[model samples]
Structures are given as C-alpha cells and as structure tokens.
Target: MPTAPALSILDRSRTRSSGSDADAVRATVRRAQRVEALGVDGFWVAEHHGVPGVVGSAPTVLLAAVAAATTRLRVGTAGVMLPNHRPFVVAEQVATLAALHPGRVEVGVGRSPGFTAPVRRALGAPASADADERLAELLDWLRGRGPVTLRPQVPAPPVWLLATGEGLRTAARLGLPAVVGGRLLRDVEPLRRYRREHPGGRVGLLIDVVVADDAEAARRELLPQAVALARARSRGEFGPLPTPGEAAAAVGSAGLTGRERADVERYLADAVAGTPGQVRQRLQEVLDRTGADELLVASTPYDEDVEAANDARLAALVPELVGGLRTAG
Candidate 1:
C-alpha cells in the first residue's frame, strides 16, 4: 500500500462561550503558526455562517490572515460553498489569494447548506440541488474554458471537491481531487470507484481526532463538539453525517443523561479518541479501511482548557506520526 502523506491541520474552532470573534481568529492564527513550526504540511479553514459556535464564515479571509502569519504552511479553504456565491466572484477571490500567497494556496470547493434556515434563505440558495452544476461552471470559469474572462490573470488554484458517496462519482467525472469525511455510511467503494474511473485524481479523508495522555478525559471533552456536529447534520445544516451515538454524542444534555453518556461511550469507541498511541492505531485502521492518500485532522474541545490541551497533543503528534511513517517506509 502507498504510505499516506503527512497529516495536515484544519482549524474548525467551535465557538467558545467567552472569547470574542477577533480573539478566536487571532488564536487560530497563533495555532496555525505553532503547527507550522511543528512541521505540519498545510492548514485549511472552514466556511460556516450563522452558527453560534462556528466563527469561520469566510475561509478566504481567514486563509489570507494565515498566509500573512505563516511562511511555509500551505493555506486554503476546506471548502467554499459554491452555490451561494457567483462563480466569477469565487474565482477572483481564490485567484487573488493564490497570487498573494504564490504557490502556497489550495482551493477546496463544496456546496454548503450554510448553518441556519434564515441564513440559507438569505443567501437565496436554500438547497444544494444545483451545487454540482454550479461547481462545474466555476471550474470552467477557473480553467478559462468559459466565455467570460476572469481578469487579473490569476492562475487557477488546485481545486479539490469535498465529496461523499455519489458526490465522489461526480468529482471523478470532473477529474478533480476530492476531500471526503467519514460521515457517509457506504464503505470505501466510492473512493475505489473514483480512482478506477478517473485514474488521475487524488483523495483525502477528514477525521475527527483528539489525542492526549488521558483517553477518557479527551473523549468527555470531545463529546459536545461531536454532539453539535450530530445536531447540525440531522437538521441538514451541512452535508451528510454519521448518525448521533454511532460515532459521536450529543453536545448538550437535553435528552442524554448519565446512562446516555455510557451508551454514547460504547457507541463511539471506534472514533479516533484516545492516547497518542491509541489514536495513531485508529488512524492506521482508518487508512487501511479507506486507502486515502491524505488525512485532515479536525480536533475540537468542549472548553478552553481542553482546547489548549488538544492543541498541545496535536503539536506533539504531527511530527511523531510523520517521522514514524517515514522510518517505517
């Protein structure tokens, strides 16, 4: 099997109760620099709007900040929702960032469901039905195949599709690289089909991970973040996601009580939560299962203290994982 590339960090900060938005952005920038110093390959920003806990509404803006702060870490959006904005505008934004950052910019595009009903309605795109077509149009515009010219002569940034299940098939048909998360119920068959059909594209997998000295503590801290994700997905706030209690738990204690926590623990055992050694083993298992060429680690914290600890753990884990993989090879 081909050894996977070095792991990359994607900053998906859950909105904390105390920190202001500026504080969170600055903190994210600091963390980006720290991770860069530790030899991470890249950093990705997510786009989430109208969510109380998610502050990364504009990934390009955040990526620009990250670009200015760090010298070597490649920066990009894990994706920009295509259907919500004009293709020309997105092309220009991405092109401008790439020009400013030179060869260090990557553009991952997706059709997002925004965050809330009001926000989606405000954007004038309440559904993702036309996202694929919009993405295709955007690609054409970026590649200079469209009739209208995208000025400023921006070289197209490498575009990656955030795909799941049949979405992978569409990505393959378009000959684009894909970044897939584990929320889809289907096996790696989508990836296999993508490779078999396209033969020239690439695939990256995103996994929620928390590696620390205390395994149970890490899981406890990660539960709220997982729960938030579950609720968001169930409401169709984002793309498809793993059913709650299957790989994650609810964030708040609305229905889940003491007994519920135990059940959640049992349900989420296979999730990537544990000590460094155990987390590494779980990652390897995921790799074996999917044969993904790249992995994006999304680490979250239930609170400030846990966030700091998780960041430190990630700082230590990156080099160790990369070095071990290299040595083993």
Candidate 2:
C-alpha cells in the first residue's frame, strides 16, 4: 500500500431543512473534538455565504470555536474567499486568531464567488480582473513587507491556497502549500507543476470517502451527499440534502428526470464507498497517483451520527494499513 499521508478534515457544516443552523454549528464543534481524540493532524472549516444549505458562512468565527475546543488539531479555514472580505480585515482577524492560539492556527484563501448573482451583489465585491493579483495583494498585506504596519503584529501563520491551474504555480511562487480540491479528484499534474516550479512545496489533497460496515450501508450513507452535489452542479440549485430514503425514492420515481438521474449516478459512482479495508486501499491508491503529502478528508453527511461513524472509520484506516500511525499536522 502507498504510505498514508497526514490526514485532516474539511467540514462544510451542512444544515438540513429539518434542523436549525445552530444544530449544525454545535455538530461542527463536536467534530473538532472528535478529530483531536482521533489524532488527525488538522481540522478545516469551510466558508460559504448566503447559502441556506450550508451554515459555515463565517470561517473565522467557526474556526475560533473549533480551536478552543481542541488543543491538538491545527484549526483553520479551507478557506476564506478573498473577494468577499477586505484583505486587511481578513489579515487582522487571522492574526488575532493566531495570536490567541499561537502555533495552532493556519490560513487558507480562495477566489470562489458566492453561489448566486444576488449573493455577489450582497457581498458588494465584483470579480477581480485577476485573482492572482488580488491574492498577491492579500499576501503582501499579511506579510507586512510594505511600509504600512499591520495591526496585532502577531507572527503570520502558515497560509495555504485552495488551488488548481495557474493558482498552483502562484502558490509555488509564494512558497506556500496548495490544497488540491475535491473537484479534481486525485489529479497530480497541478501538484507536479507546483513542485517543478518550487521544489518541496507542500501539497494536500481533498477528496470524498465513506467507510461503512458493508457496501450497501456505505452507499446508503453516501447517497444523499452525492445527490446534493449533483443537484448543485447540474441544476445550479442549492437544495437541502435529501434523506437517504428520499434519494432512493427519487431514483425510481415517475417524476425523476433523465438528466437528474444521470447527474446523481455520476456523483454516486465517483464517491469512494465500501468497507473500512476497501476505503483504506482506495485512498492509498489516490496517494500513490498524486504523490500528495497530506489528505483532507471531505465528507459532510446530513446526519451527525452517520458523520461520526464515517470519521471514526476513516481515522482507523491508516493505522491498520500502515502497521502504525503517528499524529498528523
């Protein structure tokens, strides 16, 4: 088996129509606690704005709660969208958090716009002519290499770019880590380009996986999340994740559209789902293919109990696969 890389998490803190957002936030807090107990290297909170289906609108505040709950896990965003907030304000927030937590803090940034046009208008930030230029501006502000003094004056924590394409090269030039998102499942060319540009630059992979007692149970747990993503991608509708029963009923319903069925199946087929041993083997396969140094496991099922089981099984995979596992960072 390929070596198990540093394992971490990227929690979306998905909310259900059946529950309040507060329930999701509490679940997120408990999740970081579990990550610490499981000895995972880091816990990353995602940032989504004006999306009813996702409750992690403010990563800084959510990360603060997470950092306070766990002493061992490196807490950070998966990331904060640069276009949504002023660079200096973000720098201050991150610096303050890092000052409070010291070495336990990290920063990750991205250029993703909000889910819809109204959201963009609400944030009052237009798309940058060049995201890289904006990213450069943020880095300069955070690094304080310029004449102006950045307040708090705390040591800047490690900053990672959630990237692909030229963004990988940009991160390389900046001498920082690149988090390859789940969109490009196990793609290595970006990582290769990054290393070729800046040898020894850190690379992390984020992908979805579900480990259950059996294949049927695994698919059952993965079904709703897969359906939700497909709906977002194919229909541009951010629908609440359906219950597993709802998903199954949709599959066989007279109301099921051809396009929807295909989209749902595509995501379902793409997810890694099986027994614990099988999940371990497949994840190692991804590691072997990508040569990534770390893995940010991204699985946000609507049900907390399902999520807890999935996380436990995931944390156990590497120890059994590699004979023994050490704490990750």
Candidate 3:
C-alpha cells in the first residue's frame, strides 16, 4: 500500500460574527505561527473578493506575513484567481515572494471570478474572460517564455491548479498538480483520470475537517462553517461565521426556511469532523478513494482557541502526514 499522504492547512481567513475583518487576517497570521510550531508541512491562504465571510482577498500579501512569521512552514496561495488580474503582475508578485522566502513559497492559481456580478465589475473581470488562456500566459511568464522576462527573475515557485471540472482538464493538459475539493471529491473518476493522464502528477484533496475530543464536539466546531455555506447558497451572500450557539439557534429558528436547513445538513454531511480515531479513519478512506498525494484542511471554525486545539490534534493524529509523503511526479 502507498504511504500516508502529506498534510497541510488552507486558512480562508474566515471572519467571525464576533470579530472584524482585520481581526480575521491577523488571526490567520497567528494561526500560521501556531501551526508551524505544531510541525505541520505547509500553510496556505486563499483569495476571495467581496465576500463577507472571507477577508483573504490578497493571498500573496497574506502569504508574505505567514512566511515571515514561520521559519519552516511552506507558505503559499490557494490561490490567486487568474481571471481577476494580469498574468505578468501575478508572476511578479510570486517571483518577489520566492526571492524573499527562497525555497518556501508555492503558488496555486484558479479561474474563479468575483463572488458577485458587482464585485466582478469592480474587478473589471468580464463574464467570458478566457481563464485557460490567462493561466497559460501566467505559466509562460513564470517559465520565462513570455515576450518580456519576469523581473526579479528568481526561481519560479511551484504552481498548482485549484481543480474544478474545467480545471482538472487544464491541470492534466499542463502536467501540473491539482488541489481539488467540495463536489469534485464525490467523484473519483476525474481524479483517477488526472493521475492517469499526467502520469504521477500530485493530487491534493482539500476538505473541511475539524478534530476534537469526540464526534459531537467536532461537529459543533464545524457547524459555523456549514451554516455560513448554507446561508451563502440560500441568501446569495456568504457572511461571517456564527458561534456554535448562534449556529444552533439559526438552525432551529423559524426564520430558517426548510431549504436552508437542508443546505446546512448537506454541508455538514460533506465535512470530516470527529475524534482523532474517527478522523483518521475518515481521512484514510478519502485517501483510498481519491489516491491523493496530500490533504489540505479547509475548515475555519469561529473560535481561535478551538481551532488551534483542532490543528494540534490533527497534527498528532496523522504524524506521518507531516511532510515528505510523496514528491510531485
């Protein structure tokens, strides 16, 4: 059997209803410091423009903080949305970070547009922008194949694609590693096909995971994120996470429609939340199903102390998953 996969964290800088957006960003940096001490492999931040629930709109900027605060943790974006910016600029930002951090920075790119039409307009991203073309352009600049050489010409950081359906094809075609999550995980055929086509390209599974003393405690920690997602689907706006008590009240409130309740349940069902033993079993099953090379935990609970404890437990549970499970093939 293949060895256990490497483990990493992707913090979305998810805002809590009790805190401001600035607090969330600072918390992400602090969390990076804590997790680096915990001996995890890598720490990544995300980019989400105009989302109430997320404050990580500038991943490169945030990663710089994370990289500086931690001596050993591999820090990167998960990622910078290709459609929202010029490829040359993105390359410059990544190259700058790599020059400063040396062998510690990784770059993940995605094709997702702004969260809403107005946000997209503000970003000047057209509805029909060619993300594949933009991704190719970004790769060209990063590889020194563009018309103008990328400045500060340091070694290009490793690049990953955040794979959805089209993204899976793009990553396979380009022979790049893919970070896949959500609904994509429910079907293993695409993941299998990607590995087959790329012939040993790395596959990283991104999922919501919370670890606590027992199953129910972990579920409570996961509830706020689930509630945020459910509200996003029903109300068309993803707001900051509520506390566990707030989430429970919201779940049971008469104001919550049946559809919203169903959405919350569905989101919770998709996550992996339990005691260490249960999480380990669930993670092993996911790895077996997807043949993944790495695991990226994407859960950001409402409480920082609880989140820190969760990270510690997760690191302890999967000691073998800390680093160097398998290299990108």
Candidate 4:
C-alpha cells in the first residue's frame, strides 16, 4: 500500500441549525488544535460571504485565532475569495498574519464569484468576468511584483491557488501550488500540466473524509454534510447544516423529491467514508490517481456528537490508518 501524503485539513466552520455560529467557530479552533497535535501539516479555513451554512466569513480573523491557539500548525484560508474584498485589504491582512505567525502562515487565493446574484451584488463583485482580473490584482499585491509596496514589509507566505478553471494556468505560471479538489478529480490534466510547466511544483488534494464504524456507517455520519450541500443546490440557500434527524426526515430514502434526490446523490458521490482500512484504501487510490503531493481532509459529519468530537476521532483515526499503511509497507 502506498503511504499517505503529508496530511492537512479544511474546516468549513459549518454551523448547525440548532446551535450558535460561535459554536462552530470555537469547534473549528479546537479541530485546529487536534490537527496540530496530530502532526497535520496545515489547517485551512474557508471564506464564504453571506452564506449562512458557513461561518468562516473572515478567514484571516479565524486564522489568527487558530494561530494563537496552536503553536506549530500552518494556518491559512482554504482560500480568500479575492473579488469579494479589496486586494489591498487582503494583502495587508495576509502580511499581518504572516508577521504574527511567521513561517506558519500560508496564503491561498481564490477568485470564485459569489454563490448567488444577491451575494455578488452585496459584495459588489461584477461578474464571472471580473474573477481573473481580481485574481491577478490579488497576486500582484501578494508577490510584490507590482509597483505597490506591501505595507509593514513582512515576507509573504507560500501562496496556493485553489485550482479552478483557468486558474490552474495562472498558478503554474507563478510557480504556486494548486489545491486540487475532487470536483476536478475526473480531469487532472491541469495538475499534470502544472508540473510540466513548473517542474516539481506541489499540488494539494482536498477531499471529503469520514471515519466511522464501517463504510455505510461513515456515510450516514457524513450525510448532513451531503444534505447541506444538496439543500444549497435545491433551494439556492446555504443555511446552517441540518441535524441528522432533520436531514433524514427531509431527504432520507423516501423523502427526497426530484431535484433533492439528484442533489443528494451528487453530493454523496464526492465523499470518502469508511473504516480506517477502507478509507486508507480509497485514499490510496486517490493518491495514485491524482499523484497529489499533499492531502487535505475536509470532514462533514452529521451527528452533533460526532461533529463536536470530530477532532478527537480524526486525531485517532487518521494516524491509525496512515500508520497501519506505512507499517504494512
């Protein structure tokens, strides 16, 4: 069996409908602590604007908290959506984070247009057309290649571009790592192209992970995450994650309607859920296929107890699985 790559994490700070958003934030911090102690290389939080389902709106702020709470972890945004905020603000914030955390900070940038028209309008992001320009501007600010000086003059951290569409080419041109997602699992000519263009450049794999008693059991534990995504697609609303009971009531085997059923299937298809042995096998396949240099686990469990104790479970499960693989090798 192939050994797992250096592991990392992506915490979406998904809030439960019945709990406070602060609960999610604090939970993410705790997860970071566990990730750090478990020897994960990085812990990345996301930046979503006006999305109720995700409470990690201010990634820099949350990263600062994560950094203060842990000493060794590389803290960063899975990405900051560049178009949603001013480039200057991003440059300053990242620089400040780097200054505070030193070599332990990472800078991942994304140019995703907001999820909805209202969100885009609220952020004043023009259109899909603006993404490339915004991405370029953000890069210029970070790389200091442009005329503007990054205020305070702290060294910027390693930049990772969230691989999406043409952004792959940009990351290659700049010699930055690209975080490859499962959505792009079908076609990774981009990652291949990236390595060919920038020899030996690293690419990070971001995948959904769930570890429970068994494959079916793990999938069920991850259903809330799948269901939350389905709800977003079916309703155009990204509200808090529904409780397992609530999700099962709405989209269980017999409850789903046309779009809901389709959405649920699609979301479930992207996840990797199983016992340690099963997860290890599937992740080995992913690693062989993508040849990704790093692995970033994105967990979305349904049970409130599981959600609250994710860090402990993941801390125990990941090491056991990875170690078992390595020992076998």
Candidate 5:
C-alpha cells in the first residue's frame, strides 16, 4: 500500500450568503491548484444541478478547467449520476476528457439521487429508476459492446463504483475498482466479502475528514453541511442537488432535535476530523479493518468562517498522516 493518503478535493463551492457563482468557481479552481501543489494525487469534481451552493453541475467542464490549470493532479468525477444521462452521451464526454487529459481521469459511479425530484423529472425519468442497471449499461458502452461507437475513441478511464455490498460485487464481476465510504464501515464483513469475491483487483476507501487545531470549532463549522447532505442522501435526492431552502425544509421536518443533529454531525466527522494524531490512529484502524489498497480522504471544510485557517491546518496534517501511514506500514 502507498504510505501517503491518496488526497483528493471534494469541491462543493461552499457559498456564504454573499458569495456569487463566479466567486465559487474562482475559489474551486484556486483550491484545485493549491491541492495539486500540496502533492495530492487527484481531484474529483461532483455533479449537482438545481442547487445554489454547489456549482459543479457539470463536473467534466470543471475538470477541464482543473486539467488546464494543473500539471500533475488527476481529474475526474467523484461520480456522475449515470441514471440521469444517456450512456452514449456520458461515454463520449468522458472519452473526450480522456483524450484531452489521458490516463488522468477516474470515474466514480453512484446510485444516489444526488439532486431533487423536479430535476429528475426534467431529465425525463423518475428518481426511483434502477441505477444499477443504468450503470451496467454505461459500463457496457465504455467497454465497446454497444452498437454505436463513441467518437474520438479515447481509452476508457478507470471506472470505480462508489458503494458497498452488491455494488462491490458488481464491480468485482466487471473487474473495476470499488470505492467504500467511511460511513458504511460498521463491520469488516463487507470488506472481507469484497476481497474474497474480488481476489484479482483492489478496493478504495473514502473517508470524510477535517483536521484543525480546535476540533470543536471545526465541528461547529462543518456540521451543518454534513447534516444537510446526509439528510438529502438518506431521502434519495439525486441528479443536481436540491436548493438550500429545499434541503433546509427536509432537514427541519425530519424531527431531529438540536442535540440529535449535533450528535450525527459529530459522528460524520469521526471519519475525518481531529488532530493529526487522532486522524492517523483512526485511519490505521480503518485500514486494519478493511484492508483497502488505497484510501481517499474527502476533507470537508464546511465552515466558511475558518476556511483559510482550516486550509493551513489540513496542510500541516497531511505529512503527519502520510508519515504515520509509513510508520504503520
């Protein structure tokens, strides 16, 4: 296994009340450059529409910008919601991106309706359509089994499934990499099952992380975003994400008390928030339990108030996490 945490940026634009779309885009591009300068391995742009805060509706377009701006960091989608798009269109777009960047793209696929119902309806489908089948069809198109050929004919980027359980099984059967999130690691059973079933390939683990001097303060800033996201995800809101107003209403109606909300947020942070020592220990525990070949850290600095300060804190935490991985190895 590599000693360093395979770093990647999860760009959500992170709009404050005063920020505009241009401001968010500029921040994302600048942060992409900075993350590459930090020796991070790659950057993954998310795709969400209808959401005011997240400006990454077209992750490929944003990735093109990142690719033009940076020299080394790999660029691709953490995922593109396959069900919302036709297979051929997605295949061509990704192929064109690969043609431009060449071996620097990683495609992560997920089933979640990362957007709202109206958006899904606008795309000509119900949000509850079978994503697994759509993913299989997309994979088939990428593999050149479809009757229509994607032009430019770039090699297929490495495909990854952003799930566990049967999704991992699908990846194994298809001979693709699978990315397991920290939230799903309740036990080693899934990982063990994946390894046993997928002896030929590797598994990638993604953890939500925020490293700062004041853990409490970090949590305060990060919790609202995480809670909002978790609520959306749990309710199957896919495509472009819901507006903040929409998200707020959903979360508010869930009947969670202030303390319950706080507790869930903290729990979400456990995957990736704390001092260097704390993060290092937690990462090691995850590795021992999961046997993941690569670990991807999704560092969420949700709070805008401490954005600059948290950037520095994360920069300081990187080497420690890397070194600790080396030591543990």
Candidate 6:
C-alpha cells in the first residue's frame, strides 16, 4: 500500500462575473502553472458544453495548452464525456497527448451527456446512449484492441473513471481506478465495497477543500460555488460565479427562494472548508473513511488571488495529511 495519497486539483475553468470565457480558459492555464510550481502532483481540467458558468468545453484541447505551458506537471481531463464523443476519436486524442508528453498525461472519462436539453440538442447526444458499453469500447481502442491502431502509437495513458454509484461498480468490474465525489464521499459503504471487489483498484475523491486563517473565511470562499449550484438546481441555469459579497447580498435580498436557500446550505454543508488545522482533521477523517488513494481539490473561488493562495496553502498542508509521512520533516 502507498504511504501517502496523491493530491491533485481539478479546474473547471469557471468564468467569473468580471471575466469573459476566454479569460476563464486563460486563467485555467495560469492556475495549472501556479499549482505545478507549488509542487502539486497533478492538474486536471473538466469538460462542459455550452454552460454559461463554465468554459472548459474542450478538455483535451485545453489540456494540450496546459501541458505546453507546464513541465513535469501531470495533466488530464476530469474528464471527457463519452456520450458526447466517439470512442475511437477519444482514444486518438489521448494517444496523441500521451505521445507528446510521454509519462505526463492521464485520461479520465465520464458517462454524462449534455447538461441540458438545448446542449443535448446541440451535441446531438442521444439520451439512450449506453455509457457502460461506450466505456468498454473506449477501453478497447485505448488498449489497442480496436480494428484500427491509434497513430503515434504511444503507450496508453492511465485511465480513470469519473464516477458515482453504478459507475463505481462499472469501474470495479473493469478493474479501473475511479474518481468519485458528491454523496459518495459522505457514504462509505459503496467505496468500501469497491475496494473489496477490486483490491488493486485505486479510488480518488473530488471535493471542495479550502484553507484560510479562520473557518468562516474558508467557507466564505466556497459560497459562490454553492450559490451556483443552488441556481442551477432551482432556475435550470447556472450563471458565472459571483463575488463572495455578491453571493451574500443575493442571500440577504430575497434573490434566492427558500428552496434555493436550502440547496445552497446543502452544497456548503458537503464541502470541507476551515482553517489549516481544521481542514487537515476533516480531510483525514474523509480519507480514512473512504480509503481514497488520492484527493482532488475541485474548489474555484470568485477571486483568482484567493484561489491561488488557497492552492498554495493546501500544498503546504498536504505533507501533514500523508499517513506515515506526516512527521517525516
């Protein structure tokens, strides 16, 4: 068993209220560079299509840019949605990236289709598409079992399932590692079952983890994302991130309905936000309960400076959370 869990970041390239989509994409690249300099283990980008709140639609393309901008930083998609793409094409793209970066590229794939009816129509993603079968086919191509061999012919990069619930079973059945989040983080039975079923398979947790001088300040940084989730759930549209002050104002001015208020609270409740010591304790509890092999921080604050600082703070705190290595220094 590994002595320490790997720590990484997943940036969704979220567009802030003050910036354009282009700015958001550029900011992702910059964030990748910043985290790499802080000794972060890896950087993953997300895929979203026609979402007003996110700009990371083309994950592989953005990953290519991120890879080019940083040396020694493992880059990947968090991931590419299989239902919206052809398995062969997805295999080809990841193969090319692996060829270019050698040991520095990883590919994670998901079953999600478009986020809404309009986006689904735009992508022509059929609602009935079989994601499990699609995932099997994608694996075949990546493993060189397909009719046509992928060009540049590099070794297949590591593949991780971006999953929850049934997806966990699928990953375990296929003997692949999984990155899971949401309710799965809170409920350990499924995660424990996955570990038992696939003893060699690795599990990663995706979470909103922030560190600040005080617990309140840390949670305040997560308010914007919680508000975005609330809006998405209640109004069917997730707008760009608002400043913490703006989010608090919305809560105060009856901008959010009772249901939306409850949604925001629920979202915040699921996040791990606090001072460094508090965050360390909460994360350790989570890691122990879930037996995760990796921790993927997925927090994005409205302030870029705060985001960067939090990344640095998390990096500084990671050494203390590693099991036997906590007291090494």
Best candidate (score: TM-score): 6
**Model 5 steric clash total:** 9
Error of 6 at 265 (Å): 1.0
Of candidate 3, the 10-residue stretch with the lowest lDDT total is 320-329
Local accuracy of candidate 4 as per-residue lDDT tens digits, 87-201: 7788889889888888999978886765667876887765655766766776788778767788767776788888874777888887788887856665767666776787767
Per-residue CA lDDT of model 2 for 47-78, tens digit only, reads 88766678898899999999988887898898
List model 1 lDDT by residue over 115-220, tens digit each. Answer: 4667777877646548877898888888888888876567888899988877788888888888987564136667777778877576677877787677876676
Q: Give the residue spans of candidate 5 off by over 4 A.
A: 126-129, 227-269, 302-329
lDDT of 6 by residue, 213-325 (tens): 99889878999999898999888887899999999898888899999999889888889999999989998888767777788999998999999999999998877775322
Per-model TM-score, in order, reads 0.83, 0.92, 0.95, 0.89, 0.81, 0.96
| Ranking of all predicted structures according to TM-score, beginning with the best and ending with the worst | 6, 3, 2, 4, 1, 5
Which stretches of candidate 4 lie above 4 Å from their native place?
A: 1-3, 126-129, 253-255, 308-329
Clashing pairs in 2: 41-328
lDDT of each: 0.70, 0.78, 0.86, 0.75, 0.66, 0.87
lDDT minimum window of 10 residues, candidate 4: 320-329
- Candidate with best lDDT: 6
Write down the TM-score for model 1. Answer: 0.83
lDDT (Cα, tens digit) per residue for candidate 5, span 39-87: 7777777877776656667777888888889888888687888778876
User: What TM-score, to 2 decimals, does candidate 6 have?
Assistant: 0.96
lDDT, model 1, position 203: 69
Q: Model 5 lDDT vs. the true structure? A: 0.66
Candidate 6, residue 306: CA error in Å?
Answer: 0.6
Pairs of residues at least 3 apart in sequence or in different chains that clash in candidate 3:
none
